[model samples]
Target: MSDSGPVLPWLVIRQDDNGNRYRVGRYATEDEAQKIADSLHARGRHEQLYVVERISQPAL
Candidate 1:
């Protein structure tokens, strides 16, 4: 079997404010990331979930 693992998109869950009492899951794609954000927003937890910001990919 080939020793290969599927590339997993990195994610970072953090708060947006300095209080640092929220969570945000970053994703490789905006759609995927936004989905989480939207869910939080729908549940009236936008501030708690913060925003899904994507990190710049390093040069391969």
Candidate 2:
């Protein structure tokens, strides 16, 4: 979550009407992630939904 890290913690998630979820991809910035999600949602089925979320990097 820190700006100093090179990790991409922003996630683009897709969820279906059935409540099933899948990870679309990851991005370095929230805006980037949201844009990807929006693009997917625009072209995908109407019953599906796209969202952006920030995730913490796992401790190594």
Candidate 3:
């Protein structure tokens, strides 16, 4: 199989109080993505959650 070009494995995901998840952004490194997640979390809005994840495939 051919490899996908310019893949970003790191992802920042946002989840709302209703359990709906969204992709906030993508990064080249986990640290970069986590930094964004941390900043969002620091907003102190308990109704939402931010998380970082490493994935194998490109987003659709």
Q: What lDDT does each candidate get?
A: 0.55, 0.90, 0.89
Best by TM-score: 2
lDDT of 2 by residue, 1-60 (tens): 467757788999999999999998989999999999989988999999999999986685
Where model 1 places Cα greater than 4 Å from the true spot, the runs are: 1-18, 21-23, 46-49
Between prediction 1 and prediction 2, the one with superior lDDT is 2
Give candidate 3 misplaced runs (Cα > 4 Å). 1-5, 58-60
Q: Whole-model lDDT for model 2 versus the true structure? A: 0.90
Best by lDDT: 2
lDDT of 2 at 32: 94
Candidate 1 lDDT for residue 25: 50
Candidate 1 residue-wise lDDT, 1-60, digit = tens: 124543325454546445674445546566776777667667764455446644555466
Q: In terms of TM-score, which candidate is stronger, 2 or 3?
A: 2
Instruction: Write model 3 residue lDDT over 1-60, tens digit each, in one string.
Output: 236566688999999999999999989889999999999999848998999999887456
Candidate 2, residue 55: how far the Cα is off, in Å = 0.5
- As for candidate 2, its clashing pairs are none
TM-score of each: 0.48, 0.82, 0.79
